[model samples]
Target: MIPRVPRLQVTELVLDNCRSSNGEIEGLNDSFKELQFLSMANVELTSLAKLPTLSKLRKLELSDNVISGGLEVLAERCPNLTYLNLSGNKIKDLGTVEALQNLKNLKSLDLFNCEITNLEDYRDSIFELLQQITYLDGFDQEDNEAPDSEDDDDEGDEDDDDDENEAGPPGEYEEDDDEDDGASDLGEGEEEEEVGLSYLMKEEIQDEEDDDDYVEGGDEEEEAEGVRGEKRKREPEDEGEEEED
Candidate 1:
């Protein structure tokens, strides 16, 4: 329980891996008036309710929570929040993302291991929706591959044109080629090369994910272990006093 001081001056609070649930932190607002930075990561929170509305709050870390609703509440209650970490949640709704559009000052947002990250063009859509977000899921928009370079597009178009010239009613090219079999053979070889290049280009576009999305969830277990280790540490005096008694 937070002590009822005359005027609370506490600013930073780190309550990571506390096994906290919904509504458990509702009473904090009544105590901590000047609170700013808050970290409640891995707390098993399913809903973001009753969060203290400290307008001075600039950073919030609710990572690994089971938050499925109340994103709008955070955006509304903490309008001044600049950094938010919601990684490892099961937030599947895009509307939750739309809710964050109100956070005009939000600079960094982490949504790693969340279901929303699996959607098609997920990062692009989020980037378009939240222009103020500088870093998203541990990456910047600049890191994504360009749709297609101008040179690649020009080469693709040229290849398509060559294929179109070679492709016609089945016998049309054959009739033209009968007069000069050698020339026709050469043309066919070039057509094959063009088709092969076009196929490769298509493959490259499909492989765009290889360049765009970088998975980095390998250290999650280590982070959880660190949090647990912190929770298990005992005060040296408390441990030794029992032995003396």
Candidate 2:
């Protein structure tokens, strides 16, 4: 027997492969008042007569069992069940599956590997009969895939959180803008320095040209002075020759 705890606080229970019927478990019905999920898969349960009245139960697993009929008890005991897996069971006929119609809250049901699945119009008939169910086995009436399990949902939630964290705070974008601005300013400063250097080079070239012109002018003035001196000496010699004559 499973050890007892605060059973009323229990929201989930798994008795899979226990080789016992629902009635065999002591205090399952009375103890688990808050139970919302239950799994009795492969437990060799032939009937649900002794199943607990779990109005809060939303999901139940009874796969791979010998349960052939008497599914109406589920509608009575777990009226709020949204998901039920009765796959790999002995359910053979559409009439037997019709018993689930009473479960108004049932949105998903699995009867895979069952004899009923081999029926000619099994998929069509089940959809027509259970109009409220969004998924039969794993597909909807329109053949759309069903949503993933809760564990997958949790993983998706974690991925979303990681994405949010990777995105970082809003201020991060502002920091990037500031860095771009700094780079732009640095580039402009470099451009200004290049221009200043070009201007200085032009000034130096102009000064060099002026110095060359000054040197040429000085040479020309010295040549003119030398010519005047020669002319003066020649005039003096001419006067002396005339006197001698």
Candidate 3:
């Protein structure tokens, strides 16, 4: 069955791992004239001789292909391309990649798992050749934008230390505990003093009752003495009256 093709403007095309060759790209014809993004990864591509001319191409992913050369062709054809993924290819030499320096607007390049990635100082060499690249092998290798993981870790540790400092020391908690204990003890002492004062007041009340009883006994004795003296004076008056009669 003939497949139905959409009657729309094609801006992006992806044929990853489709076992496509240069013939498939060549057959794209003018239908993809406005294509800005293309991905043909793992498609066994060996050359760019018959690749369609995509003047407005901005990103290309040709990773995992058998492409050993022709980076210059891509740079010349896709001058406006900014991002390229050529990882996992048969690129054995940096010489082929040096040709991509012509892509003045190139910002990101991925050469991971490629033969050229094994070369010593390979990243430095690439950065030297492609000064405009901001990312290499999926990592930001730009001088100013490079991430300092160690510095970030140190800053995190310093922040943790600052938090601990703000929480104060263990000694302060111990001092607070001591102060609370002292206050509790002082309250207990005040309660004991109050109890003692109450006991003393009870004893004072008992002593006042005993003193009142002694004063009552003394008044009764004085009354008895006055009655006895009056009886003696009356007996003497009776003896005088009998003698007068």
Candidate 4:
């Protein structure tokens, strides 16, 4: 009902586990321009082309669906999207992935049980093509085991909040612990040893990689533009490229 972009500004939306038929999907509009993250896993998504306008989507989950067509179109529409889940689909081959070279922001891609049994038989190296993907569905279990980092980060924030409350205010009389220690260098070593700099370094690396691309390439993106442009040109040259962002 509202203007297209503002309504789809929601970052997270999950419509997974819905067991409907093809008739469920109706119309898709430029409104989904606001979604940075979305999850429609386990839904009956036989035609993902319904969403032809969600250009700013950063994360998408369409695993366990019955997707058969319009994958390249989906990739073009979701160029900024970094995380994708195509697991548990009947997509038997790698036709759609070739067009994904345009997805420069794609970070994590899931393709578990996609009927791609003979992956080596394909022309493109599944891993080599998506070299940037840090997390792949069928493999890369160790990286995926990092779900606990979220919990640990939460605890650290909570502790910081508690300390802030006890400290009263920013300018309140609070003894600088280092002043009483006589020498700042004296305790810095101990703190570093206690916290384990190794762990901190690992966390930093993980954080850097957290938002890094899990997939790469952009030539495929140009192809997407060509395809989309064809559709718009057929309607009106003036409306060929609407400012989606």
The candidate scoring highest on lDDT is 2
Ranked by TM-score, top first: 2, 3, 1, 4
Candidate 1 vs candidate 3, lDDT winner: 3
- Per-model TM against the reference: 0.54, 0.61, 0.54, 0.52
Each model's C-alpha lDDT? 0.78, 0.88, 0.82, 0.68
Q: Write the per-residue lDDT of candidate 1 for residues 1-245, one digit (tens) a residue.
A: 97655537788888887886453564466466677789988888887767767787888998887887678887778888878889898788688878898998887788889999999999888998899987787667987433323346789999988887779656777866776998878899999999999999999987885655433343666788888777667566577889999
Error of 3 at 132 (Å): 1.6
lDDT of 3: 0.82
- State, as a TM-score between 0 and 1, how close model 2 is to the true structure: 0.61
User: Every model's Cα RMSD, please?
Assistant: 39.7, 12.9, 18.2, 42.8
User: Where does candidate 2 have its weakest 10-residue lDDT segment?
Assistant: 21-30
Worst 10 residues of 3 by lDDT: 142-151
Candidate 3's residue-wise lDDT over 1-245, tens digit each?
Answer: 98765624778888887886442354565457788888988888888776666788888998888888888887767788878999988898878998898998888888988999889989898888899988887676654543334346779999999988998975778878899999999999999999999999999999999999999999999999999999999999999999999
Q: Which TM-score value belongs to model 1? A: 0.54
